[model samples]
Target: MDDKKPLKRHEALKPLSRQHHFGLLFSWKLRKGFAGNISVNRLKAYADWFFVHEIEPHFKLEEDHIFPILGVRDALIVRALKEHRRIERLFHDQDNPKNSLSLLEEELEAHIRFEERVLFAEIQKVATQQELKKIEEIHFEIGSKEEYMDTFWEKN
Candidate 1:
C-alpha cells in the first residue's frame, strides 16, 4: 500500500513554483473574505492593491522572461497568455466586483494549476541551463516581503 505523495518540482522551476504558492494563497484569502462576510469594497480594495503590487509584475515576468523560452506559438504559451489577459480584465473590472471576483477566484486557481502541472513541466523540459540560470538571476532580485500599510485582510 504505497501512500507516497508525488515528488517535488525540479530545482530550476522552484522559484516560479513558489510564486504559484502565493497566487494560490491569494485565491484562498479571497475565499476567506467571502466566507467571513467581509465587505465587497474592502475586498476590492485589497484586490486592487494586490493587482498592483503582486499580480501585475508576476504576470509580466512570466510573459516576458519565462514563457518566451517555449516560444509564443506553443499551445501552452498561447493558452497561458489568453488566461493572463482574461484574468487581468477580471481584476480591473470596475462595473462588477461580485461577478469579477467570483470568476477571478475560479479562473486564477485553474490558471495556476495549469501552469504548475502542464505548462511548467513543458518549460522545464525545454529550458536550457543558461536559460534556467537567467531565470534564477532575474527572480532572485524580486523579493515578496515588503510590507503594505493596509491590513484589511487581517482580523480587526
Candidate 2:
C-alpha cells in the first residue's frame, strides 16, 4: 500500500467524498444487520432504500462527472463501472437477500476502497482545475429523509 496520503479532493469532488461516507456506513449497517441476525427482509428493505436514494445517484455522478476526468477508456474506469453494475444487482436481488446482502457488504467496501485508494488518486492527478470546478458546480448534496424505521442493528 502507498504510504502517501491520498490527494486532497477538490471542493467540487467533496460531495462525492460525502457519498463515500454513506457508502462506508452502508457496509457497516449490513455487517451489523447480519451479526445481529436481523431479518433478511429488514436488511433488504434498507438496502433497497439506500440503493435508490444514495447509491444510484452517487454512481451516476461518478460515471457522468468524475470518471471523465480519466477518460472512459481507462482500465480503472472499466472496472469501476463493472463493479457498479454488480453491486447494483446485488442490492436488487430479492430472491436471495441473505446472500445478496452479504456480498453487498463486501463488494461495496471493496469498491469504495478502490476508488479512494486508486481511481480517485489517479483522477485527481490528471484532472484539470476547470474540470474539477465543473464537477463542483453540478454536485448536489444528499440529505436524509425519513429515518430507518427498524432499529435492530442498534440493539446489539
- TM-score of each prediction: 0.88, 0.92
Residues forming the 10-long window of minimal summed lDDT in candidate 1: 139-148
Candidate 2: which stretches are off by over 4 Å?
1-7, 143-145
**Best model number under TM-score:** 2
lDDT of 2: 0.86
Residue-level lDDT of model 1, residues 45-110, one tens digit each, is 878877887788889889889899999999999999999999999999999998899789889999
Model 1 regions lying over 4 Å from their true place: 1-7, 140-144, 148-156
- Whole-model Cα lDDT per candidate? 0.83, 0.86
CA error at residue 25 for candidate 2, angstroms: 0.7
Residue 80 displacement (Å), model 1: 0.2
Report the lDDT tens digits of candidate 2 across residue range 71-153.
88899999999999999999888788899999999999999989987898888888888987787789368646566787667
Task: Look at candidate 2 and give me any clashing residue pairs.
Answer: none
